[model samples]
Target: MKTQTAFPANNLMGVSQPDLKGNGQGGIFNKAVKLFTVAEKENGSLIDQLSGMRASLDKLQMNVFIADKDLNLIYMNEIAYSTLKAIEPEIQKAFGLRVDDLLGGSIHRFHKDPQAVEVILRNPSSLPHQAELEFGNVVLRSSINGIFDTQGQPLGYVVNG
Candidate 1:
């Protein structure tokens, strides 16, 4: 008579639990995935809300731009891009101005005091900071605020003008 081994055979009570540690197959590790799944799902819809908000801001003749902590452009609403492009056609044309096309780009050139803008990005605060930015000959009144994550860590910045 032969005795069947459960541990070595990778079976328990006729159920097979994958050895995540050794075999690198299905296991607790698979279940440990993406704790923020629900939060992420909700966060994923933020783009829609942001778009709607941007549309509303446009209607109010406002321009909005979002940048990462490194001051890389991430989002520039239709109005922001078009308005800037119209005011600074040469700059816009110099760099192909669109969403992803504008990604990692900087709006520092548009700022009247680019260094002041840098100071704000380096500081992590929710309180909005105001700056005067130049678009060719036009001066835009810009308000910027740092975007924070769930843990209140600075994620990026939002600019509205």
Candidate 2:
């Protein structure tokens, strides 16, 4: 004879109740939907904030390049673009890409040891880092700083050279 249990087998197995079908009502599904909605809204807000910040950075006279957490080049201000453009020949020789191609490219492409650079960029404590980068005959002194969100979570890096 089987003994009666106080709770349902599904509950013991950690399965969601049938009532919580994530149908935008009270349930695990609903909670997951709400979580995703909040996350999307936060991401939208971040994008908007970044857009405004990018506008401000665009007007700066300094050569600035912004990369995402994964080190993908996202923005290169006019000064940065022009500065890189001036050395397009060298850049092409080294990376086989034009300045226009730099956006959406990986910052690692410019480094001799990308894995080492990635280690530093991913560590907040290691920044703001300063280094001199050589491209053929040209040597550029660059300052790398991590960008953080309101919660102090790293957003990316800004390279000012």
Candidate 3:
């Protein structure tokens, strides 16, 4: 004789049950769809919040920038762009003097310990790491960290002064 367990026809979230159809592909597909929808919702909200915060950084005097693993510029707030422009006026006409148009290339000009910084960015053990940079006569203190996804995979790096 065979015994059967009674599974609910619907999930707690009120998601309708998918037809198992013996192979169970339909159920897996339904679950995948649900997971993706949830993820999209969460990411959307997070993006909105982060956008506000990124814009707020523009009001501050300190320089802030984010770069990819290869050290390519990603983003810099208004203050940071203006700071760069003050340091190098020609930069504004060359590359719009915007977020990604800093120092003609990478941020390696300031980050003296690129190797250590890369290591910390790729794999942040616990807390963030601190480093100092000198640009012209200004000394900037920065905290560096790896931008990670839900699965803890490194996305890039964020530098804040």
Candidate 4:
């Protein structure tokens, strides 16, 4: 049996193009469109803020790394990149990952128990935490903190080592 919907499917295109003036579906559709428009504007603003932050972070003397909410590595300051590069060989032997693949990669690769780590990362209260990580013969101390937006939404995390 065929099903009915507030926005009927266009048989030829197989897409629902709800009427903006007719059914109650128009109200819901209009609200969703407005919501998306606002979100786009907010995202653009966030991008601008991050670009400025990146410039400042690049000038720091210490190693600094950033990861998105999904735990994907997003940014590494100059010092962080160079320091990691110097130990790339050891890292390869220890984790079987290349330093060049660090950016845009999952932070899980560095953890022995990623799910456990993820639990902490996702919980803002658990952050501003400190830990020592061992890679090969090197022991690095890291300070992890959550990054949040103006509205207190989690953007990701920052790690200083």
Candidate 5:
């Protein structure tokens, strides 16, 4: 008679266990797999919730604009285009002025005199911050907050509702 030899294959963790037939072990293993599956499902759900929150923020009634430190428009949410009109093009389109000329200073254009664009750039981040610009029956109100990057350098601006 010839001798017979059989060895179990290694699992992902490099451990080998006997391949036993059906029993209560199958139920325990199935439950563990179900827990992992549920965990993955929860992770997926959380990602979807975050996505929805972003979409809702974008669709908000308040016009919002994000700009680089140089005042170049990097992002303009939906309300921005609808409410601010040329405001977006001035920052995003670059119009006819060179990049250097367009956004050379900052996004707080109206912070100083509200009508002082053709001649100056001013720093006005003091208290009672507000701006009023007339635009076809509907008034435009803007509040600006400067933003800095992780390096603690002024990187951009955040225009809020």
Candidate 6:
């Protein structure tokens, strides 16, 4: 006997759902369609607006990182990646986490300052903090803030490099 689990419908905001045909690719296509469709409908293209902003940030001389209230990285600009590469070895040595680890999920690996880190995560409006890394060669300036929706409730953070 086989048991079945009920999966939620694809409600990614505004994207469309793909067909679930006998072909092996239908599920994947459906997911992609739903994702994009949902993104398109958010606050008259909120996701697209953010995506455009991200693109502009890539061209900036400075780096940027958007983290959540948990201090887990949501996204990083290209310059940020460059800076991370500059200090890759030291980052890994000191925190034992690769640069990619910063991009959301499981950040306990590279952060040595738990209290300070926690503060930064919890207090989004708190003042920015400067820290010296494991090697002391890289200088990272960080700022955190609560990203509110139209209703002004704390959602995540609009962190920066």
lDDT of all the models against the reference? Answer: 0.49, 0.60, 0.48, 0.63, 0.39, 0.48
lDDT of 4 by residue, 2-117 (tens): 22211112111112333346455434433333333344347653234455556656765556677776888888877677777767887899899888898888998889999899
Off by over 4 Å in 3: 1-62, 89-100
lDDT of 6 by residue, 78-154 (tens): 76677677667767776677887778664445466677666665553553344333344444444344454444434
lDDT of 5 by residue, 1-161 (tens): 22211112211111122123423433332232233234334554322332333454455445555555455555554545444443433433332333334223444443444345312222323411354444223334555544433343444444554
What TM-score should be assigned to candidate 1? Answer: 0.51
Best by lDDT: 4
Summing lDDT over every window of 10 consecutive residues in candidate 1, give the lowest-scoring window.
5-14
User: Tens-digit lDDT track for model 2 on 1-161?
Assistant: 32222222212212222233644222432343234334434675323445655665665445666777678888776657766776788779877988887788788788889989878877778977877766566666667777665455666676665
Give the RMSD in angstroms, all C-alphas superposed, for model 1. Answer: 23.9
Model 5 alpha-carbon miss at residue 145, Å: 0.7
Error of 5 at 28 (Å): 43
The alpha-carbon deviation from the true structure for residue 20 of candidate 4, after best TM-score superposition, in angstroms, is: 51
Residue 55 deviation, candidate 6, in Å? 1.3
- Position 76, candidate 4: lDDT: 83
Which stretches in model 2 have alpha-carbon errors above 4 Å? 1-48, 150-152
TM-score per candidate, chains pooled:
0.51, 0.67, 0.50, 0.68, 0.38, 0.55
> What ranking of all candidate models by lDDT puts the best one first?
4, 2, 1, 6, 3, 5
Model 1 collision count = 0
Per-model RMSD to reference? 23.9, 22.8, 20.5, 21.8, 26.8, 17.8
* Model 4: worst 10 consecutive residues (lDDT sum): 5-14
